[model samples]
Target: MSDQGNPDPTTMATDPTPSTTGPSARRRSLFKANGVPRSPREARASRIALDARERKRKREQLIMGKRFRSHFEDYEESDSEAEHEATPTEIQEINRGLAGSDEQVAKALKLLSARLVSPSAALEKFILAGECVPHLMRLIHSPNPEIQLQATWCLTNIAAGSEALCHKVLDAVPYLIQSLNPLNPDLADQAGWCLGNIAAEGPAFREHLVANGVVTPLVDLLTTSPNSQLTQTACFALSNLARNPGAPMQQLFDAGICGRLVKHLSQHESQDVASEVFWVLTYLTAGELQYAHRLVEQDVIPHLVAQLDKFADQGSAAIPLIRTLGNLSAIDDATTSRLLDHPEIIQQLLYWVAKSPARTVKKESLWVLSNITAGTKAHVNKVLKQDGAAVLTEVMSHDSYDLRREVSLGKREKLTGKMIRWVL
Candidate 1:
């Protein structure tokens, strides 16, 4: 007479526990009144529904446990709204606004950009997980310039996070590349900065950037943009693009970046711009000797020699110049001769070898001289004529093992037995 003895059919069908009657009774209860068994599709559907419900229950329990633990933990919440990570509900609202009317999209982007400006890794991860990247990528092509700019600003911050997060934003790259037009210098600058961050991830990302046609526009900005900031950003992006050893130097050469960089070295008064340009050259020359030869054809050797003399005491500026020179000198006799064409090149090398306090600079300068000495006998004479033997002897006695090793390997290998004896 009790409800347990006459359980509701709905409850019986849904419950996992068997009735006291038996397994056969429970199985019979699952069939229709006509005593036909449920079809295979119906059985499958029932099992799927049961699994979904079980999963949902478990997920809810886990979330509740996490919330309870967070509540009891010794955590101090920041008062700043920007410091706070967005909840799923809040992120969902943001996503809706992003896909909404023009006014809604603008408001959402402004809010997103403001939050990203502070560089919070947690916030970036939250936004990325919230599925905002695809929407941001869509907005990058928005006709509204302001909206496009704000969206790009958000993406730049996102890409500035870890390399894993940066990879998520790869789909936006082509759109970012298209944004690098001089007509929109501000947007172009932001886009270039974003591309630089993306390219900095690794060689694969750099290759993607190049394959997306970033070089030509970046070269245009570097050569002709009236905006100094834009030009500098372009240089930065290009430097990152060319940083890896396997970079497409031939493509960059065909784009005429080498010639433009040489002209900038001679004419640009901005030391920062010149430094960035120098880095691009260093990376490019790090490729095949043909690329270094291309730089030599640009008459880059004379400009580099002059710059090295002027900035010798400033290691930040001088190292790249020395490295570029070293890369050029390593090419062949013709290239080394072109470098030595300037009488002061050897003197500069000896000055650094004996006096420069930075071991790296000393090593690089020694590397240049070593390359020269390794050349024909005339090259060795050029080094010796500059009192190279005394500098080499001083380095041999120096405290740094690296400097001593460089001298031993470079001078001992190619120098005449007389010079080697003097150095050792």
Candidate 2:
């Protein structure tokens, strides 16, 4: 029996023979009508049939080509047929959809949000084609939680586009603020992301948020909320706002964010929130060194120092932790003294440069150390002795330094009876 069925009806059985099995001849199925070449006339008839089949196949191919060509040619001019397919403009569609039901508006905003991730031209196309931003701005106020959530989500991503594109949702700031309330943490989280993007833009966009008085309440959410999910999102928003250089540092500091962030940093065990605190600290310290004193007074330095070990070989915290340390230590007097005063800070920085898994951590540790040497005479002398000397020399060999100035720390401070330091 054949594998596929009982047997092919067209197949025939034949007796085994040397001549039939040998290469000189081949066996044939005895039961098939055309199993063997009975005569030259039979073979000739089979060849003719095959020729006809080939001609039929070519004819069919030609017909198919003509059919396709006809369809292609008529496509553009099929207006009369397509008249039934035409619909309203994109804005009209959105307005029409919104007028129907809550789910309808939510779905429309979801479609708009989905397109926001496209390339700039595509995003602009959707916005211009649908007049999306204005409709999104209006839909954000709908009483439905999901509609508000999606509107904020779309508005956030839209603002993440180019500066001109982001301007479209600037008017929606107040709505985003309203969405940040506690009735729905999910919606508030979405609103946080939206406002964060707006804050990430240039000075004008940031100024708009500040001018609208959105900063204080946003910070308050992170500081006061016990809900980790909502607080996590809020911290991320503030971090992005702080990322841009010259972001309103004093303004944020004045809002009591500094002290609250310090306290929040101490209790939050989640690395995500901790990373945001580090980033915000990095930004705040970079913009205004004066804020360093404020942070130290809040007793945040020890907590920041503790992160060097907690994240030394884990997660995304190492880079930011090291960066935060470098920024804090970069302040010549107030912050540097505070860092040295903190327990094991110098020892931790040394070990990090010597054994930390990442080169970035090691380099940032060196950064902190070099800045440390610029402090009081006692600070320079402390690194000159013990294991600190070995790491300091390793740092020197790996990095370029102005040896003339480096060796002259506190009027020629010496390491192990020899004067040396790294100027980086």
Best by lDDT: 1
In model 1, which regions exceed 4 Å deviation?
Answer: 1-121, 142-147
> Given candidate 1, what's the lDDT at residue 311?
70
* Cα lDDT, model 2, residue 303: 86
lDDT of every model, 2 decimals: 0.66, 0.58
Estimated TM-score for each candidate: 0.70, 0.68
- Once fitted onto the true fold, the runs of candidate 2 whose alpha carbons sit more than 4 angstroms away are 1-101, 243-246, 395-424
Q: Please, what are the lDDT tens digits per residue for candidate 1 over residues 1-424?
A: 0000000100111011112331111111233544343677765554456447544533442221100000011222211112123444545567788999989998776556544433345556666675688888888888987788878877876675566678888999888988899888888977887787687667798888888888888888877787766776777677667765447677787888988888887887766666667667777787777777778888887777657656767653466667777888888888888778887988888888887887767888888877888787788888888788888987787647877777766654556887677656
Give a tens-digit lDDT track for model 2, residues 162-233: 667678878888878777775567777677766866766656777788788777878888765777767766
Worst 10 residues of 2 by lDDT: 1-10
User: What's the C-alpha lDDT at position 5 in model 2?
Assistant: 6
Displacement of residue 275 (Cα, Å) in model 2 is 1.0
Candidate 1 clash pair list: none
